[model samples]
Target: MEPHTGEICAHSMFESEEEELAGQAQAWKYTFAFVESLAVKSVVLLGIPDIIARHGPKATLSLSQIAAELPSEKPDVNCLFRILRFLVAKNFFRAETSGGANEVRYGLTPASKWFVKGGAAAPSVSMIAMLLMQNDVTMMAPWHHFNECVLDGGVAFEKAHGLHLWDYAAAHPDQNCLFNQAMACNANIVMKAILSKYEGFQGLNSLVDVGGGIGATLAEIVKAHPSINGISYDLPHVVAMAPHYPGVKHIGGDMFREVPSADAVFMKWIMHDWEDEDCVKILKQCRKAIPETGKVIIVDTVLNPREKTALDPSMGLVFDLAMIAHTVGGKERSEEEWKNLLKEAGFPRFNIIAIPALQSVIEAFPY
Candidate 1:
């Protein structure tokens, strides 16, 4: 049957019925990506990962078994089944049939293991970070106005909350605490990676952690090298809430104004939160804090689009989008951008120390 020019022809429009279905399926995945994150959030809040961990790494639990562990007096078995089914399909968990009845048992995968909180081995995963980003209404509200920020060229967070992120955090004590906790979770991960892979801290007499929240990173560094005096510098209100750490002193100050003098200045994940001018200002303060023999240590992501391996750039790209949506003029930068930023701050030379993690260590010298 010949069709008119304006009439629809399914076969001609697509290569095959199967191919068209595949395209539709791919589109659905894109459309429902947020749902996947919400599902993971739900599982984390429900303590599913922790429950599975108690059963040991290799053990699997049937739907009924998992439901029994829930705090709910009368948990819905079918609803739990559907959530687990979806998570299993996405590889957050693995499904295996057991016994004569062909019952499906769910087991944790490596991805889901990150959802487990306060595990015995090493540092805990990004559960706190995920909660801060996904569960907090204050943090999530800015995303609703993300499009407006793109169109109007303003920070989405300020647009939504009518205050800067730092100011907003200060006004809201609960949000501030969560923010510090999230940063501490990240600091533990970053410091572990740095201690193993970076040698910049070997000979320093003193080190200052600019924008250090609650002194987590500084405490770890001081514990590792007892001879090196550690100073944790942050905003006044933030430092007021920090607990005292042995061999680490917390100082409240603005990095743009002045930094505590040290043999070396260390900043982790700070530069990505400001524009070039502001970064230059902070970097200059770091430079002023150290002598000609001293250097500035910046632990941050150096975006490289070409490199592909176990350390993927996808996370960096995602973080860049997050900065765009949340911060005033913050973003993840390339190696070239880092070099330029350092140079603009009067650093004559710098060295990049690559680590096994997503961030790299950049050591910038004043002379």
Candidate 2:
């Protein structure tokens, strides 16, 4: 709570001459990339974004003011400022152009606004859970064994933790909380975009959210479209703790074996967690859960090589490698890869609906 004491802020250092040398700047930047993630996580954990937002859009919090909002009254203000400086450079927060630590006031950026709990686009578990998960000691430990894993065809995660991801999460309640919370937060944000922009859910009468975790997304869907009855489907243990929402039923079962029958089956961020063969098996199971007119709607990012924006394909690429590093056969896929997988799964045809928010929807129909 006391700012984690002192450590060298390597990212703050700069070199004028050698950085200009070919790949030197880029390489050094890459080396210190972990600092950016850590710094963001630190700020989020310390409620920096929330404090700034509480001060209102027009107001700003000075370094001392921000520090006061944190856990300790006697925290080292200078160290906090150093972290703030890194965040400012990363564009997560904005500081005044000409002011000392005492005078410089920090304010939330457009991006940081989402970190505020009750803000317009606030997601309860998004940043904190995601940041912590990526920088997790357990998850990072596997990277050290990646070379050995490559040579031996062993799993980095299994090598590090002595078990696979799902098994590890099941055995560890704390890690499971992180994964579920992060997933729920992501669903909250992405579903809002889907409901606001997309029209595919307009006519569906019944829907089942396959691999829905605690049913956050389906809860949102049921609320948005009250006419549609929703089933929050996931593993037995997950549904046992799922929150009860009106018009939404939580059913416990294995998706690979059976998904509850519905007019539409929803799978968000699921296929990316498995290889093509496994993905096809899950899709085929979903197909069984629907009738002749039914469809399996995929709510996940479509890796695009054509356009680059807030949802960078590069970020998706890192996620792909991360899947390789952490899970058995999980990885992100391109549109072509998705289509081929769908064909293998016995789905006749599919349509991709693009939304401006976080992920695109791939609707695969049973013909």
Candidate 3:
């Protein structure tokens, strides 16, 4: 007998159910994305990449040798082997069989090269390391009382430590140094990408790096472009401790109060550290500091929701969370949000030049 229509429909419905389950599995891929970061952190803290890098090109170290080099209380060598196995799977390292069937030697991959000691491109290691370390008891402890922070509508860092980030930095000299190092390391990666890709800095006679910590970005720019004179502006404490650099002058003052006058003002990764109102106030000060013909070059992430599907959007999303956890009401901005902030701050026209790095160069001009 021929099959009835209702039975056929029911059979099709069951097939659709299986397909929906498959689709849900694919959609939940990001739910497991934290594994990659944890693996990277494990390799970093274990100092495996640095050891392989010290061994030179194509050099491989056996698991036992690696464990011997580590301090006492090391995890079992087999467990280390498992970690290396996962790293190999992630392409952070390469593993090969030795003469014996049981022996396996590990080598560094291109991705692992940056984690090598004294490597120029080691910003990711510095950044991840800082995040893992600083977010320990001192920082993460506040999150338990995050409800208080939210209810009080005040800065979380203050709630956690009884002062804002800047104030806390001023009081703790060692923590301040660590913060500067982290910022410098992050700036190194960003500025290197900017100097290589962007053309806007070519003709500028003078530039000011507003909120520039230790002048890392400006120093690179001046070294690359001989004709450009630069200024590194920050708070008094930061400026007093600023490292010396040829051709870049250090200026100490509050950006909200006043900025040193210059042909162009550069603010890298600074605006997102403050709220919209605070950003507007700082931008207004920046507008007054530069000439009408001069530009205010802002280096920050332009959060694009559409681009969240891409590989690097994880970095953007992570940074957005960092802002929330560390600061009060700070956030990464969208293009429209940026435009409104600029316009509200009294800037008439602006141009966005996308750097190959995570941040973009936003040049705003006064009317």
Ranking by TM-score: 1, 2, 3
Better of 1 and 3 by lDDT: 1
Q: Candidate 2 local accuracy as lDDT?
A: 0.81
Best prediction by lDDT: 1
**RMSD of each candidate relative to the true structure:** 3.3, 8.0, 6.2
Candidate 2 per-residue lDDT over residues 1-367, each given as its tens digit: 5575578665445454454464576888888878887788777888878777776865688887888888886898889999998888889888885455347888877777766665533554345666677778887888888789778898889999999988898888888878888788788778877887778888889999999999888998989889999999888767766888898998988888888999999999888888888898899999998999889999876787343446655677787888888878888888898889999898869988877554688899878
Among these predictions, the greatest TM-score belongs to: 1
List TM-scores for all candidates, in order.
0.92, 0.89, 0.83
lDDT of 1 at 336: 91
- In the range 312-348, model 3's lDDT, one tens digit per residue, is 8557777776787677678898889999999999997
Give candidate 1 regions above 4 Å deviation.
Answer: 1-23, 119-123, 305-309
Candidate 2 stretches with Cα past 4 Å from truth are 1-20, 97-102, 119-126, 305-310
lDDT of 1 by residue, 1-367 (tens): 8656887866677888899999889989888878878888888889888787788877799888899899998998888888998999899999999899999988889888777774522344455464555457888788889778767778888888999899998999988988888888888878888888787789888999999989999999999999999999999989989998999999999999999999999999899999899999999888888998999999888888343437777789888877876688999999899889999999979888887778888889988
Candidate 3 wrongly placed segments (more than 4 Å): 1-39, 71-79, 119-136, 142-152, 305-311
Clashes by residue pair, model 3? none
